[model samples]
Target chain A: MKVKKFLIGLADVFRFIKRFFKEVFYPPFEIKETLRQCFLLGNRSLFLILFTSFLAGIVFTKQSRPSLASFGAESWLPSLVSQAVVRSLGPLITGLICAGKLGSNIGAELASMQVSEQIDAMEVSGTRPYAYLVVSRVLATTLMLPLLVVFADIVALLGSYLMVNGINGTSFTLYFNEVSAVVTYLDIFSSLIKSAFFGFAIGIVGSYAGYHSEKGTTGVGKAANTAVVVSMIFIFVIDLASLQIINLFRVQ
Target chain B: MRTETDIIMPAPSQPRGNAVVEVRHVSKSFGDREVLVDFNLDLFERENLVILGKSGTGKSVAIKIMVGLLKPDSGTVNVLGYDVPTLSTKELNALRLQVGFSFQGSALYDSMTVRENLEFPLKRNLGIYNRSELDEKVMSALKDVGLESASNLSPAELSGGMKKRIGIARTLILNPKIMLYDEPTAGLDPVTSSEINELILSVRDKYNTSSIIITHDISCARETSDRIVGLFDGRNKVEGTFDELKKQNNEELKPFFNY
Candidate 1:
C-alpha cells in the first residue's frame, strides 16, 4: 500500500511539472509577480547565504591546512581551496541553504493559501493561480539561483583569501591570481548550471507539496516538511548527475 | 402540531424571470461518500436563490459545479449559455468573469492590502491597468461594501466581518452578472450576520446580479433569499419562498425552520 501511494505521488509530481511547463510558456505572463518573487527569493536569502558560505569557506580551509602541511603541500592551499569552492562547495552550500529556506517558505505559504481557499478564490476571480503563483516562483528560483551561486562563489573565495592572508601574509592580488588561474570558465559555468537545476528542483517540489496539500493546519506543516526533505534529496541527486556529466568532458 | 393542510408539498414555484443557471441530474461523490445525488437547481435572472443544507450536504459543491470549479459525475451545468463541464480553459475563464463567487472564509489574500485585493480581479480579468481607473473601481466596490476607508489595511488587520465584506467587494469590482456566495454568514455574531445579509440584498439591488447563496443559517436564508431550496440526502428535497416554506412546515424543511 505504501509503495502504491509513493508511486502515485511520484506520478502526480511529474504531472505537476508537465503542467508548469505548459502554463509557463503561455501568454499573459506574470512579469511583475515574477520579478517580485525574484526579489523575495534572492534578496531575502542573501544574508543567510553570505554568513553560511563565509563560515564554510573558512572552516574548510582550516581543516585542509594541517593535512596539506603534513605532506609539505601547504603552498598549494590556494589552488586546492579555489578549485573545491568553485567546482562544488559554492553551488552545493547555496543549493542546500535555499532548499531549506525557500522550499519551506513556498510550501507553507501555498499550503496555507490552499487551506484558506484563496486558490479557489483566485480561480473564481478569473485568474489562473497556477500561472500566477507556481510559474512566477519557479521562474524566480531558476533565474535567481545562478546569481546567488555567483555571490556565494565570490564570497567563499574572499573568505579563503582572508584565511590565507592571516596565516602566510599572502597578498590579495597574488591569492586571487592563483585562484583564478586554477578555476577555469568551465568549472564556473558547470557550478552555475548545477545551481539552476537545484533551484528548479526546490521550486517544483515545494510547489507540488503545497498545491496538493491535504486540508487543514496539519497539512500545511506536512507540506513544509515534505518540501524541505524532497528538495534536499533532489539537490543531491542533481549534484551527482552533474558530476557524472562534467566528468565525461574532463581531460583525463 | 402542524396539520396536513399546513404542510405545503415540496414542489418548487416557477421563477418569474428567465433561468440564468440550470443544474440537471447532477451527481458527485468523493471516495465512498456521496455528496450530491441527482441534484437539481435553478437561479433566475436578478433573483437571490438560497440553497439551505447542513454542513456536509454538498451545498458548496453544487455551487462549485455551476462555476466549473468542480465537475459533476453525471449531469449538465449550463451557466450564461456555456456548458460548464465541457468548456475549455479559455472559455471557462471567460465564463468565470461573468460569475463572481464569494467563499465562506472570505479567502482574502493575506499578503495584499485591501486595495490590492480589490484591484487584483480588475487588473487580471478585465485588463484594467490605468492607475486612476483601478483606484476608481476599487473605491467604488469598497464604497458598495461600506468599507472605503479600510482599503489600505491588510486582510489580517480586519475583523472577521470586515474581511467578509472585503471579500465581497473584491468580487464586486469586476461587476459580475452572477454571484455565488458560499455561506455568506457562516461564522459571525447575529448582528454581523444580519449586516452581511443586508449587504447581500443591497448587492443584488445595486448590481442587479443573480445570486445563489449557500447556507445552513435559517435567519440568513429568511432575510436574503427570494427563493429557498432545501437540500437533504444529496438532493433538493423542497423549494419555495421563505414565507411559503415557513407556512408549509413540511417534514424535510422542519429541521431548517425549527432552529
Candidate 2:
C-alpha cells in the first residue's frame, strides 16, 4: 500500500511537470510577474550564498595548504583551489543553499495561498493561478540559479586569492592568471549547466509540493518541509548525475 | 419527516422567470461520503436565492460545482447558457468572468492592498490597463461597499468585517452578472452579519446580479433571500419564501426556523 501510494505520488509529480511545460509556453505570458519573482529569489538569496561560499573557499584552501606544503608543491595552491571552487564546491553550495532558502519560501507562500483560498479567488477572478503563480516562480528560479552560481564562483575564487596572498604575498594578477590557465571552459560550462538543473529541480519540487498541499495550516508547514527536503535530495542526485555525464564526455 | 425521495418544488404563487443558472440530478461523493445526491436547483434572473444548510451539508460544494471549481461525479450544471462540466478551459474562464464568487473566508490576497485586490480581476480578466479607468472602477466598488478610505490597507490590517466587505468589493468591481456568496456571514458577529445581509441586498439592487447565497445563518437568509431552499442529507427538502417555510413548519425545517 505504501509503495502504491509512492508510485501514485510520483506519477502525479510527473503530470505536474508536464502541465508546467505545457502552460509555460502558452500566450498571455506572465513576464512581469516572472521578472519580479526572479528579482525576489536572486536578491533575497544573494547574501547567504556569498557568505557561505566565501567561508568554504577559505576553509578548503586552508585545509589543503598543509598537505601541499609537505609535498613541496604549495605553489600549486591557486590552481587547485580554483578548480575545486569552480567545478564543484561553488555550484554545490549555492544549489543546497537555494534549495533550503528559495525552496521553502516558494512552498510556504503558495501553500498559504492555497489554504487561505487565495488561489481559488484568483481562479474565480478569471486569472490562471497556475500560469501566474507556478510558472512564473519556477521560471524565475530556473533562470536565476545559474546566475547566482556564477556569482558564488567568483566570490569563492576571490576568497581563495585572499588566503594565498596573505601567506605567500602572490600578486593578484599572477594568482588569477594561474587560476584561469588551469580552469578550462568545460569546467565553468559544466558547473553552470549543473546549477541550472539544480535550479529547475528546486523550483519544480517546491511548486509541486505547495500547489498540491493538503488543507489547513499544517499543510503549509508540511509543504515547506517537503520542499526543502525534496529539493536537497534532488540537488545531490543531479550533482552525482552531472559528474558521471561530465566524466563520460572527458573519457570520449 | 421528509424522505430521501421527497423533493419540494418552488411554490406556484411565487413568480418565476428565466433560470440563469440550473442544476439537475447532480450527485457528488468524496470517497465513501456522499455529499449530494440527485440535487436540483434553479436560480432565476435577478433573484436572490439562498441555499440554507448547516456545516458540512454540501452548501458550498453545490456552488463550487456550478462554478466548475469542483466537477460533480454525475450531473449537469448550466450557468448563463454554458454547460459548466463540458466547457473547455477557455470557455470555462470566459464563464468565470461573468460569475463572481465571494468566499466564506473573504479570501482576500494578503500580499496586495485593498485597491490592488479590486484591481486584479480588472487588470487580468478584463485587461483594463488605463490608470484612470482602473482607479475609477476600484474606487467605485469600494464606495459601494462603504470602504473607500480602506483602499490603501492590506488585508492583514483589516478586521474580519472589513475583509468580507473588501472581498465583495473585489467581486463587484468585475461587474459579474452572477454572484455566488459562500457563507458571507459565517464568522461575523450579529451586527456585522446584519450589515453583510444589507450589503447583499444593496449589491443586488445596484448591480442587478442574480445571486445564490449559501448560508446557515437564519437571520441572513431571512433578511436577504427572495426564496430559500432547505438542503438536508445532500438533497433539496423544501423550497419557499422565509415566511412560507416558517408557516409550513416541515419537521426537517423546524429546527432552522425555530431559532
Candidate 3:
C-alpha cells in the first residue's frame, strides 16, 4: 500500500511539473499577479529566513569551536564558517524554512480554493488557472530562493563573525579577509544553483499537493501538512543529487 | 424502482431556438458508482432551465459535462455547437469565454477583493483594457448584484448572500452568453435563497443569456426556471414548466413536490 501510494505520488509530481512547464511560457502571462505572488512568497519570507540562518551560523560556530581548537586550528574558524554557510548550511536551512512557510501557505491557499470552486471558476471563465497559479508560484520560488540564500549567506556569515569575535577577540576586518580568501566563486555559484533547485522543489510540491486535494476542508489541511513534509524530503533529495553533480565537476 | 434505462429516455427535445447547449446520451461514472447515464438536455438561446435532483443524483455532474469540466464516459456534450470533450485545450479555453459558471460555493478568490474578482474575467477573458470602461463595467456588474458598496471587501468579509452575489457579478463581468449555475441556492437561508432566485431571474432577463441552474431548491426552480427537468437514477427523468410539473399525479415524483 505504501509503495503504491509512493508511486502515485511520484507520478503526480512529474505530471504537475510537466503542466507547469507547458503553461509557464504561454502569452497573456498574468505578469502583475505573478509579481504579487513573488512579493508575497519571497519578500514575506525574509524575516523567517533571516532568523533561521542567523541562528544556524551561531550554532555551527559554537559547536565546532572546541573540536577545531583541540586540533589547534582555532584561527581557521572564520574561513571554515564562511565555507559551511555559503556552500551548504545557509541554503539548506533556508530551503527547509521556506518549505515550511511557503509550502504550507501555498498548499493551504490552493487547497482551499479547490474546495471552494475558485479554481473551476477560473477555468470556466477562460482564465487559465495553471498559468496564473502554478506557474507564477513555481517561477517565483525558483528565482527567489537563490536571492534569499544569498541574503541568508551574508547574514549567517555575519553571525559566524560575531561567534569568532566572541571566542578569540578576532577583529571584523581580519575575519572578513579570512572568509574572502577561502570562499571562492565556485562556492558562491554552487550555493546559488542548489538553492534555486530547492525553491523549485518547494513550489512544485506545495502546488501538487494543494491542486490535487480531496475530501474538502479536512483535505486542504492535510494537503498543507503533506506539502511541508514532502517538500522537506525533496529538499534533501535535491541536495544529495546536486552534491553528486558538483562532485562530478570537481573530479573532472 | 424505475430507472431511466428501464423505461424512460430523456424527453424528446422539444423545439427550442438554436440549441446552444446540448447533452446527449452522456453517461459518467466514478469507479463503479455511475453518476450520470444517458442524460440529455437541450438548452436553447435565452432560456432558463432548472435541473432539479436530490443530492448525489448527478445534477452537478450533468452541468460539469456541459461546461467541459468533466468528460462523459460515453456520449457527447456540445456547448454553443462545439463538442465539449473533443475540443483541444486551446479550443476549449476559447469556447469558455461564452459560458459563465457560478459554483454552489460562490468560489470567490480569497486573496482578491470583490472588485478584483469581478475584474479577473473581464481583464483576461474579454481582453478589456480601457481603465474607464473597465471601471464602468465593474460598477455596473456590482450594482446589478446590489453589491456596488461592498466592492472593496475581501470575499471572506462578505456574508453568504453577498458572496453569491459577488460570484454572479463576476460571471456577469464577462457578459457570457450561457450561464451554468450549480446549486446557486444550496447553502443559503430561505430569504437569501429567494433573493438569489430573484437575482437569477433578473440576470436572465437583463442579459438574455441561456442558463441551466442545478438545484434541489424547489422554490428557486419555481421562481426562475422557464423549464424544470428532474434528474433521477443517473438519467434525465421528467421535464416541464414548473407549474405543469408540480401538477403531475405520478406517485414516485411526489417527493420532489414537497417544497
Give the winner by lDDT: 2
TM-score of chain A of each: 0.98, 0.98, 0.95
Per-residue alpha-carbon lDDT of model 2 for A1-252, expressed as tens digits? Answer: 999999999999999999999999998999999999999999999999999999888899999999999999999999999999988999999999999999999999999999999999998888999999999999999999999999999998888889999999999999999998999988999999999899999999999999989999999999999999999999999999999999888787
- Give per-model TM-scores: 0.96, 0.96, 0.94
DockQ of candidate 1 relative to the true structure = 0.89
Worst 10 residues of 3 chain B by lDDT: B2-11
Which DockQ values do the candidates obtain, in the order shown? 0.89, 0.86, 0.87
Order of the predicted models by lDDT, top scorer first: 2, 1, 3
Residue A79 in candidate 1 has what lDDT? Answer: 96
- Model 2 compared with the native: what TM-score? 0.96
As for model 3, its CA RMSD to the true structure in angstroms is: 5.2
Q: State fnat for each of the candidate structures.
A: 0.88, 0.78, 0.93
Q: Compare candidates 1 and 3 on lDDT and give the better one.
A: 1
The lDDT per prediction is 0.91, 0.92, 0.87
- Residue B98 deviation, candidate 2, in Å? 0.4
Q: Backbone collision count in every prediction?
A: 0, 0, 0
Off by over 4 Å in 2: B1-14
lDDT of 3 at B108: 93
Who is ahead in lDDT, 2 or 3?
A: 2
